[model samples]
Target chain A: MSLSVAMPDRRVRATAAVVVAAVLVVLSVVFACAVGAVHIPPGDVIDGLLDRSDPVTRQIVWQIRFPRALVAALVGANLGIAGVLLQGITRNPLGDPHILGFSAGAGVAAVGLLRVAPEVPLALVPAAAFGGALASAALVYALAWRGGISPVRFALAGVAVAALFTALSTALIATSKLFTQAALAFLAGGLYQRGWEHVHQVWPYTLVGGLIALIVADSLNVLALGDDVARGLGMRVERTRALLAALAAVLTGAAVAVVGLVAFVGLVVPHIARLLVGSDQRVVLPLSALLGALLLVLSDSIARVVVAPGEIPVGIITAIVGAPVLLILIRTRT
Target chain B: MRSSARRTTAILGTAVAAFALLLTACGTDETAVPTATASAQGTATAAATQAAPVGVTVTDLMGRKVTVAKTPTKIVTTSPSALEMLYAAGGTAIARSSTAAAPGIDTSKMTDIGSAYQPNFEAILKLQPDLVVADASAQAPLAGQFEAQLKGVPVVFVGAVKYADVATSIRMLGLVTGTAEKAKTSADAIDATAKQVGDAVKGKTATKTLVVVAGRDGQLSAALNDSFIGDMVKIAGAQNIAAELKQSGQVPGYATISLETAFKDNPDVLLVIVPGNTPGPSISSIVARTFPNLNAVKNKRVHEISLDIFLQAPGPRAADGLKELTTFIQPDVKLGAAVVPGY
Candidate 1:
């Protein structure tokens, strides 16, 4: 049930995992559409998408449910891909957007700008977040680098920088009494009332960052073969590492800017993908995307429907699922 | 930021004239909530003669039997609004829930208990309050968490989600504290003012409104008619377009609404809730930039009210929110001065 590099049928397992993930994602989306504060049957949801449903029903399906589910998927996939890159480059299993301070940096800067200069167009806020994430990553990378960034050094620097940014964000939130609702949503990460506008705001980053990931993914595999071995094989280790780190930061910052900081996707999804398919970057990257998409879509659907109109934060669901799966992976991997 | 932001964000009206109303004797010492006294405490000395009883029994909003001293002089509230009501009902609080809520009181001198969600048991017990009031909307069934620590003190629950609930809570507490006449006097004043405002707006065509609490930075929670503020919205002759949305996880009467819904409704007015008197992020800008097509933003029908006049100022100044809401709905409606409970 688990995969390793030694497995003979790696390609077949990867293909099967991708297919299963894709099917689950589609099913999860349909399930999410069928259940919400306003219940629309799954068959009717499909009909509503085709414009064959009632006006109110059609609006809910198209305007609310579909956009929300898709945004969750994209955000999840973006984070998953980011996690794969970080884990590969850092060679640390715990490497992810949240642990690395990229998400925390994005949250603090974006929320700060939202409070201080809210006059800035909402669309532009993600750009600010992207900048903040890049800064934090560069800071961590610089702090960790003696001659070059080591895996242990990077992880430690990330933890310290993440703590600093998280504390800063918490302090900013405490300045006003009104941060209760919005801050709760931001802290726990949710899709409450998120719609097409959010999708529109986020997709461009996902597209560009995802393209960047695909371009450099081959380098990730070469980098995993040790720096000296990769150098002997004609790989520019540090340059590729820097490029992959930038791409990971961009992908995570974009998703977090729109949906707040949804935890566990980046840390947990890559492991599941690796367990499903042997750790080849080309297979692992795409597989991580699909697995991440499925995990979030299913968790998000459960989050919204279980409570209906009262949305439990999707982050809670993801962590609830991610934590157990993470423990299982940790226990089983050795 | 406005100069008002510096001069204490706490509204002074909540810490109103306790001594003024204290002299009045209305004999309201029955209980705080309706049917709670007789129901949950069905057997606890119910048959005892009504001649100068040492304690009055009443059921709280959580359906718990609470027996308070016939005259509780030392009172504490887990909610800022309840503390305000206690003051309005000719009673003084030995401790109050949160300092961030300035209910017309000089809160600097008062004993600060923690917030309703995380009350400081040590601070509360140190004050040795005879009667402790918690928010039914938020702190219901809370006694179980501190049953051992309460040490026989009565913790009453009061619902303050509606404008009517404000009057109801004051009357209930007044009965418990033997200040029924004063509580009645204050609650009636608010209701009378509200009725006057309602009567004025009743003639006018109702404006479709969306009451938004963006008190937390740049976040938005649509206020429904069933909400504490929404009751005032309807009473003030504004139609809560948000009221129709199904309830979400944001407390009792607030809902999560997409910008698309706002665009679809095209509400005639937008009432914005900002934190303190400090300048807040403008909703019009947020809406204009993000939801430019919204009618409220297009028509410049957005009104920003301090959180004090509306959300937190529940008890005596419930009418203040009513007046603010009515004026927000129909700008032509003239309002009399001195009716607003606090400045």
Candidate 2:
């Protein structure tokens, strides 16, 4: 529907939204770095950033908060871009990374590895999750395939696969007495205790996934026009959709690997981006990334300070904050 | 239809009158013996002195008055901690929750009654336990269900997350099981060890400490001052860095805090509780990488503690846990044998 807007007007609106979102992302990162379980003054935060503050403040800012906030920003970007790509590929408004059961698949494998073969280094957990996510994605693709993918059939298959994966994840967590508490923390999805190691783990995936989504943005837009029209336009419709789905799976897997299954950010951020700018995939993708980063950083900061000392999972905060914003945007836009 | 309605009304009136008569009789009995109901805090401990062979009335952790009629020979404990306390009180369960395993307690022949959070009530009933011990926090909800289905069986909820409560739970179990003397002995051992550890570290500079409990899935959570391990640290003359962090009630006495807060606190010692049979890089290793200059890392004070004694089964062995904590907190001081109890 937003595609009917004049191209020039849409461009201006997208540019504005992108600029605002980017600014908010930067501000939210700074805010996240400043506030935490411990109180550090704004000047101290700046001084800590420059390595001029006291030892404790310096450690809190540099070692703890800075790495955590960066991880949150990168994860938000990954989930946001993944949401945009999946929604584009499926041509379904409800499409997001979780719609394809990526998070649940990743959760099952990651949790299983952690419980069953805990001797494996913590660093390999993301790989395990990524593998699980891709496996489930393959299954969804196979089930959805009837010579070519129809959007509704694909979505239905995805839902069925997601339910099956979720049940498997629950069973794994339930049967293993050892894994219950920590596995639950992972399943609830949070950036709790994330550090420089997590930042190092996720950034490469975000870069690769974001680039892929951008390179194929034009194809996404053409595909959005309907498959028959896309084929007539000389596009390889099935190949493009498959590539986009695979790309989204990678992005979603990366995000889930670090923070478990954070809900709402991937589901709602793309819609917000489209409502703000227009239905342009090129604009919606980057803007959604920016908005996703902004929303998560802010939500993470709230997660830190609201209960002060005890942290709420970042995923919980995202759902509480994202659902309302998406609803308001939808109401005002309609 | 009118005659049937009249007969139903007559029956309902008879039942109401009988219920009122029963209530008056109970009220009169209570009024005649005002001292029959025990005091709130020391109800169980006080009841232990009474040599009532037929029955004993006491208050449980949930504040419900429970009457254990006849010595409870058959018992079921729904949590590991509850099972430990029961054993410390010189009582044993015919069946135990699957997760209930503790030091010095044998469960090889006991029937597995499933998880404490949702036990198999039918299996428990099949065992026909005279007493059912449940955890106050985790198994509190099952109390109503147990009462409804167990007929005359006494379901006692006893969850001890702190050092003081550990002894209280043991004594409560002892009084109910008619093993009060053995229970008092174990309870006294806990108090003696606490004092021993406290006195040994009294003059030393209080070590700043942080306790990180690694979950089976490798998630790290801080043990607050109110947690069983956290309370032990305090008693061992150390300042818990995460003590001030408010518990959000996800897990009683534990909180998930950002590693940043931990970094800022910069404790002198780090104690990581690792569950038994877990194999991997200790949480201390992860902490080491994140903050290499942490005092605990720099000074070589990061220690891995056993999850079984400190957390999973916080019972008679808590005294041993305290002694272990002191070795890390103030390694120089050695307590005399007075604190050690023969269990």
TM-score of each: 0.53, 0.54
Computed on alpha carbons, the lDDT of every model, listed in order, comes to: 0.71, 0.76
What range of 10 consecutive residues in model 1 chain B has the weakest lDDT sum? B19-28
The CA lDDT at B88 in model 1 is 76
TM-score of chain A of each: 0.91, 0.95
Give the per-residue Cα lDDT of candidate 1 at B221.
71
For model 2, how big is the CA root-mean-square deviation? 24.7
Error of 1 at B261 (Å): 43
lDDT per residue, candidate 2, B90-178, as tens digits? 89889888777765667899877766655655456657788998888676545655654454568888866778888888888899999
